[model samples]
Target chain A: MNKNRLTERKILVTGGGAGIGQECVSKCLSEGATVAVLDRKLDKLEKNLEKDVSINSTVLVEVDISVGEQVCRGVKQAAQELGGLDGVVNSAGIDLVSEFDDMNWDDWSKVLDVNLTGAIHVCQQALPYLRLNRSSSIVNIASGAGLVPIQNRVAYCASKAGLIMASKSLAMDLASSDIRVNAVCPGAVDTDLFRQNIRDESDIEQVKSRYAMNRLGEVSEIADVVIFLLSDEASLITGSALAVDGGRVFH
Target chain B: MAGEFFIEFEQFVMKQRKVALVTGCANGIGRASALSLARSGMDLVLVDIEQEGLDVLRKNVIDLGSRSAVICGDCQDEHILDEVFEFAQRDFGAIDVLVNNLGRSAREHASSFLDSSPDTWSAVLDISLMTTLRVTHRAAPSMKRRGWGRIINMSSDTALIGDEGLADYAAAKSGLLGFTRVLARELGSYGITVNAICPGAIKTRAHDHLKPSILEKIKSTIPMNRVGEPEEVAGLVSFLSGDGASYITGQALAINGGRYML
Candidate 1:
C-alpha cells in the first residue's frame, strides 16, 4: 500500500497480452513499479487493458521473448525506455492438450521454446541491469504440474520442471551478486488461457476438485505472492520455488 | 440473560473454530510457536514447563476468544501426554492442528565434542527430536481418521545453515526435517500434511544481551534488513493449516526474512 515497496523498479513481464500476465502488469503498476509488457498481439494486449491510464502508460513491446534474437533486442529497447531494470518476471508460456504419445515434436518444441528457453533469454538480457540495482529479484512463473507430474502434459510438465530447477541453480550461481532468482508454482487458476485449454468442462471441474480448496485459484492471489517475492520483504528468499496455488499438492 | 448469552456463545464457538495442541510450548521457539497458532482462530492447548508464562498465554488465548488448555509437563511423559489428549477431547473435541513445537536450545554446554555431556545431548534430542515422534505418533492416527489435519514442527534455519554453539539443536532440528519428509510421504495418501517452519534470530526477550550494533550488522546481512515478528510467522502457519496448503507436504520452509534462501 505504501506503493514504495516496488517504487522506481523497472520490471519486464513477458506474454503480457492476456490472463495472468495482464494481472501481473496491473498489480505491478499499482505498486508503483514501472513495467514493460512483451507480447505478440497488439490488438489483444490493448483490448485486455482499456480506459485505465495507469496501465496504458506501461511500455508495450510487440517482440516475442521466446525468440533469442528478438529477446536480445527487445530487452535492450525496453530497459532503455524504462531507464533501468530491477526485475524480470518470465510469465510468458503456453499449455497444450495433447498426451505424451500423441504429442508431436513441434508441440514439444513450442512448449520448451516458450516456457524454458524464453525464461533464460529474459534473465540473460535483464541480469546486467539487475546487477546495478540494489535489490533486484527474478520471479519465474512455473506450474504445479512441474512439481508433481500431471497426467497428459508431458511437454508442458518437462518445460516447467526444467524452469524450476533452473531457477534454483541460477539462485545458487547468483548468490554472490545482489540479484536474486525464484519461481512461483501456481495451480489451476480461472485464467482465460487455462479455460480455453480444457475441451471438456467436466475435466476442468475434475481438476478443481483435486485441490483442497475445491475451487479454482484467483489470479490476484498468485499476483499478490509474485509481488511479495519481487519486493524487499522477500529479500532473503532466493532459489526457493514457492507455490502460489490454493494448496494444491501442498508444496 | 446470562444463560442465553452462554448458549449463543457456545454455538458460535462450535462452528468454524479450529483447535490445536502445541507441544514444547514452554520456552524458546515453542512458546512463540504456540502464540502464532493461536492468533489464527485456533483454540490452544499450550504445553510448557514455565507455569507463569503458561498462565499469561492461557489468558491471552482466551482473550483471543478461543478455548485454552494449559498442560505443564515434559512432552515425552506418556502419562502426562495421555492426560493432555483426554483434556483436549473433553475441552475442544477433535484436534484440527498439531504443532510439534517442543525443543531445547543449549547455547553453553557441549561446545567441545570431547567434553560433551550425555545428559545434555539426551535432553536436547528428547525435547527437540523425539518429542516430534511421540506427539505425531499419537496425533497422526487421529489426523488420518479425520482426513484433514496439519502437523508442523518448529525447526531452525541452523539446520540448513549451520552455526556455532548450536550443534545439538541443529542435529535435532535436522532430524525433525527427516521426520517431516517421511511423515509427508506416508501420510499423503491419507490427506494429512506435514511441514516445518524454520525461523532465524527473532528479537524475543531471550537475546536481551545482544548489542544493538551487532544486531544492526546482522540485519544488514539479511536482504530484508529486519527481524521477523511472531505474527509474520503465524501468517505462514495459518496458511499451512487451511485448505490452501493441502498440496504442500514434507517441506522445510525457512521464515528467516531472507537470511538463508535455501
Candidate 2:
C-alpha cells in the first residue's frame, strides 16, 4: 500500500474514463508512476480523482480506441507527453446485451472492434515505447464471461475471449522484447454503472447467490491485482489470465 | 532430534501473532514460502523431514523480525502431524494459514507409463496428495473455530497439461485441484479459502543438476522462453495468503512463465 512499487515508471491505461480502468489509472498514480489515460471521454478521469491522487500527476488523452489510426496517434502522444511508457492496461470495452438470434452485424462487429481490435491497436502503437524501458507489462481487462459463457451476450463473450487468447499470443511474441502481457478476468464488478443498473435488492441477492463468495468484487480489489501484475513482483507471471472474481462457481 | 520437536508452551508466553504453518520447508519452494510469509509478518511453524535446513530457515525468519518454530519429521505420519497442529493450537491458539508444500516435481525418471508400476503410483499419490489431506484434516478444525484460514496447495502445471511420462505424478498433483474445490465449497461459509498453485519448470535443485542443453530445451517449450525462480512463485504465495486474496478460492493459479494456459 506504500507508494513505491511503480516508482518513476510511466504507464498508459485505455478506457480510464470510468470503472475499473479509471481505478487502475488513479492507483498507478498513487503508486508513484506518471500515468496517461486514453478514452473517448476524459472529464470523468479528470474530475474523479481520489483524495490522495493529484491531477498534476496524470495526462488525459481523448481518442476513440476502436480506430487503429486514432489509437496510433493517442498512444504516441501519451508516450511523448509522459516521456516514455513502461506499462499499458487495456480496460476500454463495451458489452452488447443481445441473444445470438437478436444480434445484428453492426452490434456484433462494433463490440469486437472496440473490445478486441482496439486492444490490438493500442498494443501495436505502444510497442516502440514499451520496448524502450527496462521492463514493460500489458494488463488487458478481460471478463470471466470470456472464460465461461454468459447468456444474452454472445458478442461481448466472443470479444473478451479473443482478447484473452490474443494476450497470451502477444506475450509469447513480445517476451524477447522484455514486454509482458496478461489478462484480468473480473466477474460482476461492483462498479457505479453495475450498481445503478441492477434494479432491485432481490436481483442483487440472486447474482450474489451464484458465486461461491456470495458477493461482488469491489473495483479497488481488481486494481490491486492489476498493480501487482504491472510491478516487478509479477515478473514471472506473463501470459496468465488471472481471475479476480469472488470465487464464482465452476472456476 | 532424539525427542519431541515441540518446545513446551509453559516456557514462553507472548502476544498473539499471525501464525502460518508451512510444511516441507527445508528446501525449494517450501523454504522460500516460509521465508516470504515471515517477511509478510507472519509467525511460522516450519515442518520438514530434515532438521538442518529448518534451523537455517528459522534463523532467517527470526532475522526478519517474525517468530519461527521448527517441526522436523515426515508429514505422512499422522501422529507427527497431529502433534504439529496440537502445539500450534496450544501455543498460538491456532494456525491462521497453512501452506502444503510437500509436492515435488519428480525427477527420478521419465520412463513411459508402460514402464511404470502401480507401486510407484501409490508412493507418488501418498506423498503429494495424501500428505496434504492429512495436514489439512488436522488444520481445519482450529481454523473453523476462528472463522478465517488460508490453505495453499502446491500443484504443477503438468497436472493440467500432461507430461510425456509423468502420469503418476500428474494424476497425484491433479487430484489436488479437485480437493481444493471440494474444501473451498465446504469451508467457504466458515471463512476459509483453499486454492492450488500449478507452477511450470522452476529452477530448484533438480534444474541445477540438469545438463545445460536439457535446460535450454525445456525453456524453449515455454512461451516466456525461460524457467521461473522460487522467489517469483513465493511472491504469488505471499499474495494468496493476504487479505487482498480473501475473495479468491478454489483456483489452480498457474505461475508458469507462459508455458501453459487453462
lDDT of 1 by residue, A62-128 (tens): 8776688898888888899899898888889899778667789998998899999998878988898
How would the docking of model 1 be graded?
A: incorrect
TM-score computed on alpha carbons, candidate 1: 0.69
> What lDDT tens digits, residue by residue, belong to model 2 across residues B120-213?
7778889999999989988888888888899999999999899888888899889999999889878877888888998899988877998999
Residue-level lDDT tens digits of model 2 in A78-185: 999999999999999888777678789999999999999999889989999998888899999998888887778899999999999999899989888778899988
Question: What DockQ would candidate 1 receive versus the native complex?
Answer: 0.20
**Model 2 CA deviation exceeding 4 Å by range:** A50-53, A249-251, B1-17
TM-scores, chain A, per candidate: 0.95, 0.95
lDDT of 1 by residue, B1-262 (tens): 9999999998786756888888766555556556666766688888877788888878877777778888987778898889888888888877889888777676546475456777888888888898889888877887789777898888888898877667788899999888887787677667777888787776565555568897887777565566766555655666667554655666677776567764
Candidate 1 segments exceeding 4 Å error = A1-63, A68-89, A94-113, A120-138, A143-180, A186-236, A243-251, B1-13, B26-38, B59-67, B112-114, B162-167, B201-232, B257-260
Docking class of 2: medium
TM-score of each: 0.69, 0.94
